[model samples]
Target chain A: MAVLNMVSALNQAFGGEMERDPSVVVLGEDVGRDGGVFRVTEGLLDRFGADRVVDTPLAEMAIAGMAVGMALNGLRPVAEIQFMGFSYLTLSTMISHASRMRNRTRSGMHVPMVMRMPYGAGVKALEHHSESMEALFVQVPGLKVVVPSTPREAKGLLISSIRDPDPVVFLEPTRSYRLMKEEVEEESFTIPLGEARQVREGDDITVVGWGAMMPLIEKAVGSVGKKGIECDVLDLRTLSPMDSTAVLSSVRKTGRCVIVQEAPRNCGVAAELIARINEGALLSLEAPVERVTAPDIVVPLPQGEGHYYITPGRIENAIERVANF
Target chain B: MLIDDYDPLKKRMLQVLDQEGKVVNPSLEPVLDPDVLMRAYRTMVLARQIDDKAVILQRQGRLGAYPPNRGQEAASLGPAMAIGKDDWLVWAFRELAGLLWKGLDPLRLYLYWMGNEEGSHYPPGLKVLPAVIPVGSQLPIAVGMAYASMIRREGTVTLSYCGDGATSAGDFHEALNSAGTFRTPNVFVIQNNQWAISMPRNRQTAAPTLAQKAVAYGFPGIMVDGNDVLAMYMATQEAVGRARRGEGPTLIEAYTYRMGNHTTSDDAKKYRLEEELKEWEKRDPLVRLKAYLMNRGMLDERQEETILGEAKEETERIVVEAERFPRPTVDDVFKHTYAQMPRTLTEQLERCRRLEGGGR
Candidate 1:
């Protein structure tokens, strides 16, 4: 196993997949000689040649739409959206064609491709660089949403998404791109989608979180342990096909649940999780499921973001509210 | 039929059987062998039977609503025979006869009208896309396929078949513009059957002729007597060969008529004249083809009876098979939504299943 950060792991995954299948091609702004804005595709152009590792124009629509047409012709395209904010422009093409091709054609055609975008707050970047908008895609019927919190999961899940026979939106939380690191395999491998990873096990209560909030949940879980509260922590790696079974089972055992997400509270993934548990494990619950999420507002500047976003202290307090209820 | 002195266009257009019975063409005469002629007649007969059965099934509440191709059989089959089996054919809703020419199972088409998504699934390498309902959307897709073929240096050509109303759509312009710029291997066939539902051709466009619109797109445009099977086949063959030889796309406007209501739900009597129906009745494509064959001493009354008898029996067998085909499950509706089912829909499916006591 080799220890690598998110950028390095992504580079290895791209290199491995491109070598494994010549059909795989990467296209985005500055992904060639510049190796992408974040260097995630570093040295890929030299290894795979410029034809396959394309440095496309700075047009997100062209990058995404052309990938759709290319995928329709039997090529596996991995397009980079650079940032979540810039990804909004690609939504129309994705929803109109890529998502509905199978249904509209009555399963006569399939789009095998992936749209990779980096998103999250707390990176102290420019405007549109950090925005958590995975929830926007959650409502789309045919799109699978995957958010990896760790480098190991990033490479594996990305490979799996690329190889999968459908279109996928892979959101990489930029805050954790360098902050979180783990040992990953040199050989190519894939992690099955729609499955959750149990980060920690306990019996008193359950803490469910995903993406950029995983580390904060970890910290809160440790602090709550000092208060003698045994908490089960689950990292929901996949958002679209949420692990309802694992979540409900954990809530049933603890008789309580606290959900965490970086998106706004009103209509975020946490809201959906709470509704699922309320509907499924109503008898098993000792109290209402609590959600520790960002308020319904635009992600604030780095200085005041601590108040608007979910933090370790806020999660700790929410966990206590459910435990003491 | 009105057998009298008329204009040359009308005289050349309103044909019923040659003096013999086989269909004939003037501009480019194609030698039709016994086998080819039988195949063409069989496909035409099968297409009509399928359209008739489908409309009745819809009326009887057995199949979903559909657009019927009652009078334009040769407009679809004539060109369908011009292309190779491996060539791609992108269709709008009114080209049911083209499916038979592409060797699609009649039962599968019936299943589709029965509301099963699986109805559009053709065999591997058949190169036929499912029916496109949004009118001209398939035009750009056909252009894209042709462009890709050009990039790969493949000899394949794409043929797009649509109706007169589709010419008004923006997608049609995009496709034509792209084909013009790239000079891609493609043939655009417009089945101008006079009316788009209740709206007539004059309402759909102000242009003198639909074929003439192709000149702006840098392609030759030809108006054929759609009711004349020989003229349509010869015209399409010339255009298709031109495309295959890298000359670029051509627009073929087959001038035909809609003999019946647009679909079962429509009542042509509400908007059309009873006298107009009689006028087009004299130009029946099938009758003209039979007369042409008879004029060439190729067919007789006994052969016509045998052919129609075989076509009817085959249609009956297909109708029985289509009726016997099993229904798809509710879960099957959720399946194949994507290459793999999305998680959001999976949960929705589970909720529905749990409510239905976990059933099909």
Candidate 2:
């Protein structure tokens, strides 16, 4: 084990996978020589050469569409979309082709590729930079949406995603890239998708979140714990094909739930979780579930980011309210 | 090189056989085997018959809305004939002739129009992608496939088809630009069939010729008389040879006409003139090819009758077989979504099965 940041851990994942599998190729704008916009693919071009680590033309749709073709032709391609905001350009190909290739051809073809992008607010970046749009991808069928909160999860889940036989949208948390350090295993390891990890076990209430919101949820749990309010915190690693069993069981045990998200509130993943809880664990609930999310509005520019960004204070308040109720 | 000689910017169009079915460019004419020529002619005829029957089927409520490939048979089949067996063919929805030449069973095409998913399950080693409905979306996919071939040193080229209107889409430019940058073995054939639904070619772009667009992408582009099968075949052959030799991509603009409605659901008479249809009818690709074959004594009137009669019988058999194909089951809907269906999907499928009265 070695202590590393999310960027280093992910770079190790890419390097390890490419070295192990000759069929794995990396392609995106500036992914070759420049490593990546975030340097997550640093040193791959030199290590794997240009054929395996390609710097594509500055067209998101082509990058994604070409990745689909490459995947169909027996290449495991991991394409980066620079940023989540720029990823919408690839939705045309993702929704029309990559998401349906296997179903349309009835198993004759499948897109075994990954589209990686840095998402979420609180980075105070420029317009179209910090976007938490995981909900958009989660709603798309035939796609696996994985968001890794820590260095270990990022490396493990990404390797598993690259190996899976379906297209995966791996959204990296921009705020968590270099925020904290952790001791991550250097060797290849896979955290199976559709399984949630229980960060803290408690009986007062169940606090559910993922991606960039995990840090805030932990902070809220810490502050509420000081107030003698112990909470159960669950980090949902994969959004699509969600680990509903974990969430339902946790809610049933605690008899109270509070879902938090960095994305806007309307029709978000939190809403889906609440509906599922109502379906399976409603009779066990002691109070109505509470949701803490950013309002349904455009993520503001740098100066106004703090106003729209979800804070730990808001999460703590929601957690305490559910705990008391 | 045919591509360099008939540059679109120079307003030069390549033509081996003129409108009268006479060899106008003997030096550029390809010396194809007699059997190959006969097969090419037969495939074009069969494609036309299928189009006609498909239109009637749609009208008779036996098939869904179908697109007609009336006058653009040579524009599609000629390039298909030039493609090697290992080459990939990525087609837009209206390339019936090319699909037939690539060995796709007519029953599958009929089943596709009859609203069945199994129709897209092409046999192994056919090297053809299912029809892409969105305009210009398949271009980038072809480029990617070609790129993969180049990386793997597969020594295989990719041929893709689109109509004139697809040139207006951003994906067209992006795909060609990438193909040129990477110099992948790709041949982009644009069947400039004169109409995109009701919109005419003149309204689609301000460029004098659609083929000139390839110039901006740093590749050779040429226009051909799409009604002349010899020119289409010759141009594509040269382009395919260039790609195989690692000389990069080539763009061929097949200047043809849509001799039928855009689809069975469309009515060309609503916006087009009768005189225009008459002018195009005289230049039908099948007629031109047949006249040339007859002049060379390779095909006779009686032989032509036999070919048509055989195609009609085969098409009837294909229709019966396609209609009798098994319907999709509930499991099929959930099976291929993922390599292994998730528990949620399996549960949903089970619920659907129970709802359908197959309780277990």
Top model number, lDDT: 2
Query: Clashing residue pairs, candidate 2?
Result: none
- Candidate 2, residue A265: CA error in Å? 0.9
Compose the digit string of candidate 2's lDDT tens values, residues A1-325: 8999999999999999999999999999999999998999999999999999999999998999899989987799999999999999899899989989999888888899999999988988889998999999999889999999999999999999999999999999999999989999989889898889999999989999999899989888899999998898999999988998999999999999999989999999999999999989999999999999999999999999888998899999998898888
lDDT of 2: 0.92
Please list the residue runs of candidate 2 whose C-alpha ends up more than 4 Å from where it truly belongs after superposition.
Answer: B358-360
lDDT of 1 at A68: 68
lDDT of 1 by residue, B1-360 (tens): 111121222322333234344434352467678778767776777788778877887888988887788779888888888888757888887887777988888777887878877787777678777777766666766765565555455676888898898898766776776677668788898999999889999998888788778878877777777876666777777778877888888888888889988777789899999999898887776777777666666778998888888777877887788778777776877886876665557777897888789555
Q: Give interface RMSD, every candidate, in order.
A: 4.1, 0.8
Candidate 2, B1-360: lDDT as tens digits: 787789799888999887767789679878999999999999988999888999989999999999899999999999999998899999998899889999999898998889988888898889999989989998888888899999998878999999999999989988999999999999999999999999999999999998999899999999999888889999999999989989999999999999999888999999999999999999999999998898788999999999999889889998899889998988888899888888778878888989899566
Per-candidate clash tally: 20, 0
Ten contiguous residues with the weakest lDDT in model 1 chain A? A57-66
Per-candidate RMSD vs. true structure?
6.5, 1.2
